[model samples]
Target chain A: MNNQIEIQLSAKRKEKPSFSDLKFGKTYTDHMFIMDYSREKGWYDPRIVPYQPITLDPAATIFHYGQTIFEGLKAYKNENEEVFLFRPEENFKRLNRSSVRLCIPEVDEDLALEALVKLVSIDRDWVPDVKGTSLYIRPFTISTEPNLDVTPSQKYRFMIIMSPVGAFYKEGMNPVKIAVESEYVRAVRGGTGNAKTAGNYAAAMLVQEKASAAGYSQVLWLDGKENKYIEEVGSMNVFFKINGEVVTPELSGSILEGITRKSVIELLKHWGVPVSERRISMEEVYEAHQNGQLEEAFGTGTAAVISPIGELFWNGEIISINDNKTGELSLKIYNTLTGIQIGKEDDPFGWRVKVE
Target chain B: MNNQIEIQLSAKRKEKPSFSDLKFGKTYTDHMFIMDYSREKGWYDPRIVPYQPITLDPAATIFHYGQTIFEGLKAYKNENEEVFLFRPEENFKRLNRSSVRLCIPEVDEDLALEALVKLVSIDRDWVPDVKGTSLYIRPFTISTEPNLDVTPSQKYRFMIIMSPVGAFYKEGMNPVKIAVESEYVRAVRGGTGNAKTAGNYAAAMLVQEKASAAGYSQVLWLDGKENKYIEEVGSMNVFFKINGEVVTPELSGSILEGITRKSVIELLKHWGVPVSERRISMEEVYEAHQNGQLEEAFGTGTAAVISPIGELFWNGEIISINDNKTGELSLKIYNTLTGIQIGKEDDPFGWRVKVE
Candidate 1:
């Protein structure tokens, strides 16, 4: 399909938000990318129009059946005015995998990447040149058919929206407190956990809210079956450093395959640090802490590259890691990943793709 | 809060679809009920207006986080042209339970029920008067806040839309073939399986589509943990008659509390049938079938009052139930439930609520 994307620029541009006061996903760029899919025509008519509200029938499957998938990546601007994206191809690839799990149609990854580059190029001014801010790109697909049947939709819409987000953490890379959830489970094996879909996040909200009310920043979920194996923390993949070795939960079909998690593992291996991807249970962490071997723990995701764990509360027991301060290794990983993302470090892994 | 619902009738009535060719949820009535919820005002501004499309920001929480819940019920028109709702209060009650699980705010059940009845009364003309037809009512709530955060939304919209649906089975109450799913599990014990939310349905689509492709009407899901116990079939609750006794899966935290399932149990008990709700593993089911003790199987839901399962395919083996015919008990339950719904039988259970 020789599908050339059509561009329709906005007639009047709106005032952009100040980068200093930018909040995540609260502001949008001048233009957005959209494409439609149908069982009869597949995906067609790719277009970039002004960012605006989307009108849908109240009975659209997205609202009633939650047939949606999304990917989050950012376009970074350096002091040299050059824009770069961090491993965006992987996001589109993962999006297609999510589509298969939700029974949505697979998208053309190459075409989707082309569309992303074109969209960023069209809205280049929105990319922030500040120290820690970047233009967050969100590409999502939703079932648009107005059918109430509990079946795969026959029509869909794929869209890309941009938001200039400030630093994830207001202060420097500080550690956060997270509570271990015992009553609620986010996802399980043979479920939609591996897919970057909406339901998984929805299922975790109540637990997160309760944890937040108790003065914790996030909730750490345990496995659904035994409720002993650690899965993930909030929406991020987690890692723990015990006795001079780093270990994270393996991709056990119930945890998200985060891009940041993959990059962190790759970076650790490149640096020759001992890193293992295996099942690290909460009991093991507690025992490591008791033995004074649990040195540091942190979470990895696109939002916060490395969120240090200051404290963890599990079953009425509290374990403080690294004296409730950021660990040296956590700080190093955060700086390295961010440096590579902003073009300050050498591109040894070829993870960055230029927008121009 | 003294809330009097305001009504704004549609100026131009839509051309009603022919009752003989009506489809489920395809065509909607002229009007709909809508209410808004905000952190400060709670649920307010209850009103009924012309059915129309809803406009939302592309980053609305409902589209990204799947923060939505819905209920399905029917309004029947008896021979006297009186409209009746079958336990709609129960739907609103269940909606609140689903909202709690998804972290959305709870709505007032009494006010929502009043709104439903008022909306039905205004659209009473749209209710089909055919023998097996009724107005399918869909009451749903969605997060309307334009935010990309994984937290619960501060704003929400509750709506009710009605559709004239024809008989679920076009040709008599013919039995259907169902394949037991082994690869994809729908919901887990501690997950959002019990909630009538969008994610659960979305997760079941892939397996359902595969089963349909293999000449089955639905896919029967197994327990997510063990994959040995029966969970549900498609979107409905399942029941099996074994050794001259009626049994359904007990209300585990993972299975939906289906109103139709409750009604079936009530009717069975009222008639002095030996009914039990407990864990029934697939191994036991296969053994029963082998011993010729599996007498009948069926599913219960609002869409289909009682869907008889004529054939079951599990682990490369197929067993024809009641010689691939609708069981006598299945037919009896269907007729009794439909009779009560249409006011053809005595309302001893007080299941029906008059709309006018």
Candidate 2:
């Protein structure tokens, strides 16, 4: 198989968006990486072309069966005008894992990674140099077979689109208020919760919309079975600090294994802060708040390195964390991860892959 | 809103497939129904045009977030060449219910139904006249906004497509074997199971594929919480007759409220047969089998009408039902429903809607 990716530049380039006024996932770059997979041909004809609309049959399985999966990452530009991607190989690996769960065909990971680097390198100017601004890369796979059957499609399309996004925390990493969801569940064990599939996010919209309408930034989902154990916060994996021990829910096949969550655990262990993954319940969290043992809480994801939780509302009771301010440890970890992500800090772990 | 539906007929009509060789969802008619929805304009511009491909942005919410919902019903032709629809208004009502859960804007149900009747009337010839062949109608709504956010899209497209499909059971209404799912789950109570959304079917693909690989025609999904109580069978609602008592799992918010299931219940009540809907566990089913009270088992859906369960394999224990033959009651119910659907019997319940 030829590893080369053919490039087709856009004849009419789109005007770039202002770096400071960009919203998440709204602005697109000049080009995108695309590849197709067939049951007989595997994956072939890899190319980077001008970003455009895709035409599909009205009965395409992706539009009717939700046989789609996606991964989220970002490309950063340091002060020296160098582009770097933080562990993009991990994103491709997770994409394949999500493919297996969604019953879609997986792609060649090495070739996918190569396509990403080349695509980003071709559109390097789109990587913003401003602080807290980067090129958000979204790699997604969709079933394209024109059939309305509830089975996996024989044809698939894997594409990578980049958008220039401003910082998730526009106001200096301020914390967010979250509401505990008791009525709706995001995912349950033995479901597609662990995989980054489109259905998981679609199943979560109603609850998230309700939380937003209630003036909360996001919803803290409980386990789908008992609706007691904490699962996640919005689209990110959640973590809490209580009585000097940092804990997040163990991945019990129903929670996403967030890359940022994994990196934070590693950073905490390196700094000698006690950390563990176990089943943590909402009752225990509320009790810790009442006992004054809840020092800090935050969420981890690629979109935001750390989203500190300022307040939590459970069953009409509200508790403020760290007096509605960013905790010391949360700030430290955020800065450390962001520093390593861009080329500002020492890369002892070798997580960043340069786009050369 | 203008209730006028614009029409654009296909200039070059394609040859229709032979009725005897027709497959499910593979052969489409010449035209389709479409409507667009926007937050500013609401649902407007209903029209019927030639069947064709739909172009959408790569970042459309339907591709990345799975904000899509669909409904399925069939158009049957009588011996006198009259076309009829079975409980189509109910399908539209459920579509709005699904829209509420997925956060998509609801359509004007009355206008939508009018459009469907008009479209099917234009393509009325596509409704086959064979005994077990009809035109399967699929109405779907998809989020078309080009953004990668996890929130609901402000713009959507609702479309109706028709396909000439052969009988789900080719060689008469024979029984099938079903394997009980022990590992994967279909949905949870607080999830989007009750709604006819794309995600529910997508999540069940892996389990269904595994069951098919194991020589089972379909899978019997248990509850998501305890995995004990019977939930559904494949894409259909399940019913069992134990010791002359016909019972099915109640509407538990996780299982779909099938229209055929409702029709069966009403028919049973009209005939004074012992019928009930309540929580029925697999353990009780196994025990009923041991006691020789498991007389019949079958599934109900629009596609198959009634699919009898010849055998069930649960946790390595295989049990045959009704001597591996279609139960007498199952056949009676199938005949009654299909008879009403195709206008062979008097519409005592007024369930058939003529497309005129």
Candidate 3:
């Protein structure tokens, strides 16, 4: 196969739908980019086809064993009508990391970057210009082996699907209350928790329900051994502010290394805000809260740049942070990230990867 | 459903194929049992339909998030044409336990047991009369809501699918070599490790591949916190013999409480084999190997009653057990399990539930 990508556009296109007529992930664009791989043939059949349902055997490995991994990024439309990806190379790196853990073959970095550019360039109109909206790009790989035994699939498919999504904070970006889940574990050490696999997301549903039932927005997962130290929030990486110093949980074997978490650290360091990636125990957080030293708590992810956590419930006790309001470091870092993402400020760190 | 199951059976009858043509999970019978639950409608629409493809949106939770769980059991055929399930009620109890953790609605125990019996009766021809072969049953539930956000699915479908399976061991039960996975953790504390979900299976694939690459059969998972204590072998629960006593990992949050493991324990107890479930640390196992106290090790699962572990690769060292041969206890357990399953002896505990 040649290094060049061939553009075969979809003949059938859907009537353009308004961004308002869409939900988070319920609506999709007219086209999708797909590529296949096998041992006999490396990578083949790269095309942009009309978005349609994928036909899988009832016994496909993905359905039975959950051999799947995915990535979430966005194509932002700047005022100058340019489609840009915020540090797409980071997503590419993370995608391969996830692939290695799921036993799926990794894609060529050059080829994957080219495919992302081609997909976004052809579907540029899907990039919504709403303040908090963007063209959400989902790149995923699934094991398509037609076997019943629990083993890694020999064949896989990498696909890029685009969906126009609105503000993550549908009502408003109010501080969220969370329940600290001490009983269940989403991922353990020597597990695939760091990998953005479908299993990790699926495994979190029960704990998420428990959090909601406890009248909290999400659950803060503790370490797998003792369930005492804060690990992560699954979808997002967590951070805490104590006496104006930023402290996030040190990446144990199970916590996901989020792209947003990385960017937040760099941004805070660049802005000269005190930061530390050390072990942050729940007991310490509670003690700091009681001593009026815990000033802020927020979660960072692709969907939400920064979501402030106002109240937290642990061991049948509830504690509030920042007077139940978003914090100073959070607002500053959020401004910096979105500014660099939307081409409104200088990309000192060269985090923005322009598609066109 | 009525107090008595009003089964709507499919008229289509599948011709029985030769027992030699049995595959692991490919072929299925004519009818499958199904029951559904809704917020308004609680556990309605009990029917037996011809095996068919389930039509679902591409964005369904099962396809993306992997919110799926399944239980595996088998029906064995005896010489006198009697069919029995090896402790099927245990499977039902475990299934509901998994459902509670996944937040999926649970079916009535009596109704579920009845449905299992009815389904097995309808497909009794698939059960092989061979000593080691039987018809495998897979009862699974999946979240079917077509949405992309991170929340529990409201709609779910409970289904039972049966497939004719060959023997796990063709000629005789052979010992297997295992690769000790030090890098990955399958399940963690305070997570869904206890639940039988797709994520846990998917999480073990990478390690499984690694073990297979190194000419090993399975990977031994370590505790997520320390990666030292023995947890499980992913699909099968592991057992170790030290000083002539059998010790398996305690039912910690991360280990799957396998039906075969429980049954073997019961069978051994009845036969006066000392057995205990406690936290067996890897340090103890390794030290015992050096002390010549570690005699034999094996794993138990639905597919295989007892698979002996011939060797283990841990920390760049290979420890051989039983001289790469099947142990006495392993063969005894396998014979007992297969005997009880095939109804060759008196089932004192009434573990065998009659299918036909």
Candidate 4:
């Protein structure tokens, strides 16, 4: 409640990684933000401590029950060495939403935002300035209670760790191939699918491995109950340009409410492009492609910003779009979004927050 | 792959809890068993060390992705002070099955069983000898890789921790009231429902809390796809006696293949009772009750052994079974199964494995 953070600076900072050759989430910064919560004390002991290993009891609820939630966002450094975070408030808000679903306590968004700004400022040297490089921030909460009861935990820890990441794809902005997965389902209505919890990602690993083995970058998941309607592509929200109209899956209870997906819709609407959020089935998409109405398709997420979908493998058929190249609108949206992120373009919507 | 285990006993043991006043999973033994796995070395390091907290990087996959699996069994002590594990080999085999589903590497069942037996033998003094008590054995595997990628981890830790647990229910082996969960689904077909994974349990917490708040011991889950067929009760499998026949939901993908449930069916068959495994819908169950044919209902799991269901709350109606008392068959099953566990009865099925 006091919003005062106890800061402990690292005695020595490690040598920075080569930004040009950095791998996503493989390198960490010098300091991290941590806050603890308990039923008796609520949320307390907010601190910025040296990045290090964390100790947990052997019987902690997290190890046995997987009671955890996480949020991912990035911090960009401009040519003038000015660091910016894009729409960070939304991430914290969504984190609270996820906590509600997972039965974990909510963190004070204002305090969390303050903590992030201070942490990024203290570790500003870790933010990469190279082209297509940024600091990937991961804020996660895990149950720390040492009990085996199948119930909500009474103790928890909220932490923010950061990593310097290279571009999401090795081929830069080239299109990727995604295979449609029909065997394993990610989430369903009245489930934790919409929440950014650990279990959802865990459920997708096996299927993603299979897709990768088949030479696809990711897998497109359908609705859990029927396995017909498109829910998401890998972990990102998907969009399609059909008959010159922009359409994406509705905010179904089973699909994650991605922040970037919201921004893409707003940006399209702002540009006078017709965009709609509705249930679009895989059958409908294939039929549209058969009718030559499928124009472009891409996925929106914080990791890639915009990943153009060039080829889709479904039912043993390979459907290539836009001649297996990035769509014109996809490139424009990527450039504009990345520009706005780096403070190169005007922040018409006041989406950027400085790290100072 | 040497099966020889390195051992380091605890220098000083902690005070043992009173067997009559024990709590489930609250008091642990002095030492624990551990095995480490890496892609390069496989599962190599096998050791028994002092029970202590584990250190992990903040970015460990288990914290953010819930890449973990676990198994539960019990070790009982007879009057002769000899310890027996109730079908522990089955638990390890099921653990490997869960690993396959969660994309975790499967442990050698024989090796895991050997480690568990050895660990339990060393901690035999911790086994409670009370009428309704045993040493709860938790064998779990967690991803230890410090990476943010959504793929399966290459590093893992398998551990066995012992806890002296009292009776699962504070009221002894009495019947429990169950509320039908129609809102939050535990898991769906093609999901992690059948796996003994952390994510499945994590997804059930919020609903379990609601059930507890509403004056119910647990919630009876319906199928996620249609919410019509009976799936499970809490984390256990359920059965009903209708018209002199015992019926349970079949081994559907969304229901856990409970070892206790299997033993119960076998015991029923051994007694020449008519038992069937099929899709048991709530409507059919209610109809059977209305027709005065639903004789008994119970849940089966390792924790409770056999939990009789006395009342069901669904659609604003209370369906009281067996006059809100434990049924004859329920009591007989609980007594027989628990008797066999503690070596008080004939081990006809060879379910008990000695810790020697």
Highest DockQ, which number?
A: 4
Tens-place lDDT per residue, model 2, B1-356, is 77789999999887999988888888789999999988898888899999999999999889988999999999999889999999999999999999999998888889889989998999998999888899999999999998887889999999999999988878987899999998899999899989898888889999899989989999999999999999999999999999999999999999998999999999999999999999999999999999999999999999999999999999999988999999999999999999999999888999999987
Q: Given the true complex, what DockQ would model 4 score?
A: 0.89
Local accuracy of candidate 1 as per-residue lDDT tens digits, B136-255:
999999999989878899999999999999989878988999999987899998899999999999999888888998999999999988898998988999999999899999999899
Q: Which digits, one per residue and each the tens of the lDDT, describe model 3 over residues B1-356?
A: 55455566667677876776577876777777777666677677777777766666556667668777778899989889899998888888988988887777787877778888988897787788866778888888877776778777767778888888887888787888888888777887656677787788888877787778778888888888788889887589999989989999999877888888888888778889899999988889889999999999999998888889999889999888979899998888888778888888777888888876
Which candidate order results from sorting by lDDT in descending order? 1, 4, 2, 3
Write model 2 residue lDDT over A1-356, tens digit each, in one string: 56578899988878998888888888899999999888988887899999999999999899888899999999999889989999888899999998999999888999999999999998998998888899999999999998876778999999999999987777798899999999899999999999998889989999898889989999999999999999999999999999999999999999998999999999999889999999999999999999999999999998889999999999989989999999999999999999999989888889999998
Candidate 4 residue lDDT tens string, A1-356: 55689999999999998988998788899999999999998999999999999999999999999889999999999899999999999999999999999999999999999999999999999999988889999999999999997888999999999999997765678899999988789998989999999999999999999999989999999988889999999999999999989999998889999999999999999999999999999998998889998999999999999999999999999888888889989998998899999999988888899987
Kindly list the per-residue Cα lDDT of model 1 for residues A151-179, writing each as its tens digit. 88999999999999998876787799999
CA lDDT, candidate 4, residue B91: 93
**How do the residues B126-203 of candidate 4 rate in per-residue lDDT, one tens digit apiece?**
999877789999999999999998889999999999999986766666889999999889999989899998888989
What are the clash counts of all predictions, listed in order?
Answer: 0, 0, 12, 0
| Model 4: per-residue Cα lDDT at residue A252 | 84
RMSD of each: 1.3, 0.9, 3.1, 1.0
Off by over 4 Å in 1: none
Worst 10 residues of 4 chain A by lDDT: A166-175
Q: Which portions of model 3 show Cα errors greater than 4 Å? A: A1-22, A78-81, A169-172, A316-318, A353-356, B1-18, B21-23, B26-44, B287-295, B315-324
The superposed Cα distance between candidate 1 and the true structure at residue B105, in angstroms, equals 1.6
Q: Give the per-prediction TM-score of chain B.
A: 0.99, 0.99, 0.96, 0.98
DockQ of 2: 0.86
User: How well does candidate 1 reproduce the true complex, by DockQ?
Assistant: 0.85
